[model samples]
Target: MDPTEVNVPDVKDMNIDNITQNTILINSQCESERVKYLFERLVTHLHDFARETRLSTQEWKAALDFLVTVGQISSDDRHEFILLSDILGLSLLVDAIDHPKPPSSTEGSVLGPFHSHKAEVVPSGSDISSDPKGRPCLVLCTIKDPSGAPIEGVKIDIWETDSSGHYDVQYAEHDRPDGRCVMTSDEEGRFWFNAIVPVSYPIPHDGPVGKLLKLLKRHPWRPAHMHFMFEKEGWDHLITALYIHPDPYLTSDAVFGVKDSLIESLGSVSAEQAKAYGVREGTALISRDFVLVSDDETQRLRDSNALAAMADLFPGKKIKLLDHLPVPDLD
Candidate 1:
């Protein structure tokens, strides 16, 4: 049966109850009850959304072309589609809907395009600072309970851009290391780092996503932030990004990563504390703690990690590991 020829209810004549009744009727016959129910709900909502937005023919065609470009540019080595979704704020919305963490816990943000699996894991107090010429930063981090008591033995995987606001992936040939650190907290639940202060930077604007953003009159920049993933044996593994409170794009990040709870002031560290952390004078530091809820679904959390790891595992069949190796900065 042709859907266009069917006597579907018109937008002007539709009400919530009528839509609900139609949805129930649509679910009455199907090979899979689950799929029938799901599609019924989805169709009604999608129809209502299109009607409410008054979707235009030109706008819809543009949207389809944008998505086609996204798929066209994607490969095993690159996921421009995910990057497109991220810049459009769709990725964050999906993450929010799928994983509703505790209100007091750290909020999840966009898992940016450059997340690599090859980061070297370091222990507490180990310096993973990549470039020495960049502005010095001492990150004093803690993991604790809601009452503020330190929660020892928590592991934190971290990464950020350099003073120039470029990630390692951007300078594929330059070989400079932008701050990428993986460390665990000590017995006192404290982990301090000596790193170059990260700078705000634009998202990759040379790609299709950038062109789309230009068409929409949106910038291709994200606010200054440090990515952090916290994990513990019995606690929920939290993946989040912390934004510098004073970042200019706090209200207008191109990637829409900014969240009110994730913003924290990068305070001035006293000379004594700086010296204790081996940070020289005049260097700035940011201090913040993450709180994680206990993880009851261990298998599900492990499965998610396994999936991410597998997705990024192998390069093309014709390419060798060394062939895809990033150039190291010999200078």
Candidate 2:
């Protein structure tokens, strides 16, 4: 029973097309089981999509070209590929699946296309805004554990758009770092910095992603928000955002990063009035606290899953499952 020629369609270079989809999924045998499974599933879905869409060779070539352009524009300071994933909602989906929010931990959001390790480390309440055109804003934050205890010495990296809704990366000659800073928490896990209140800005549409959005009739505006990357040894790194409440795009963030829990309120204050708080009188004030989970706490939560932990809710009493009943006739 020779199977290669029996069931296989007889044609020149027949395996090239794989139109039958019976081709054995070929992958490296060295890959782990999970990796192999993921690769095979991805291939299956992609091949199926091509077949179902009856994708023409021209369309496939166009997609390849589009990707090439995206790569051409991406560099050390820019990430056009990440921008593509963001607008397509894949970034948010990946984050949600990878970091499912446990208990009181802060929710994660997209890191966006513009983040740089070049941010300068500064003291608490230092003015990070080199763009004098930007409106002054005082941001105060505290990091604490789920048990309401302070987590000292956590490093907080803050970055946001200029008052004009433009990041430092957008400007080619802005050699000086503005609108970004790295600060550490005090003994009380408190840290603050002075900057501009971020404005809702459009994701750069000058590249292939912009063309895609134009063809799809979609907007690329991210709501007003700030980015915070909280990191410390032995603790889960927090990549999250604080979205300014009442932003017009809150309900429809282009990257799908908005969450109700992340919404923060802003207060307008005078520089003289802010003098009491030790800042140079920032125009807007934002005070919020972030909760981080320790590695041990995360492990404990994992060992005692949600359902297991709920056992205490009904001490020794078994909960009954309700029966499913068929729909009654309206007669």
Strongest candidate by lDDT: 2
Candidate 2 global CA lDDT score: 0.79
TM-scores for the candidates = 0.70, 0.82
* Model 1 CA lDDT for position 97: 48
**Per-residue C-alpha lDDT of model 2 across residues 162-230, encoded as one tens digit per residue:** 988888878999887888989999999999887887789999998999999999898888899999998
lDDT of 1 by residue, 263-287 (tens): 8777666889866876676577788
lDDT of 2 at 133: 80
Q: What lDDT score goes with residue 48 in model 1?
A: 76
- Residue clash pairs of candidate 1: none
Model 2: colliding residue pairs: 271-281
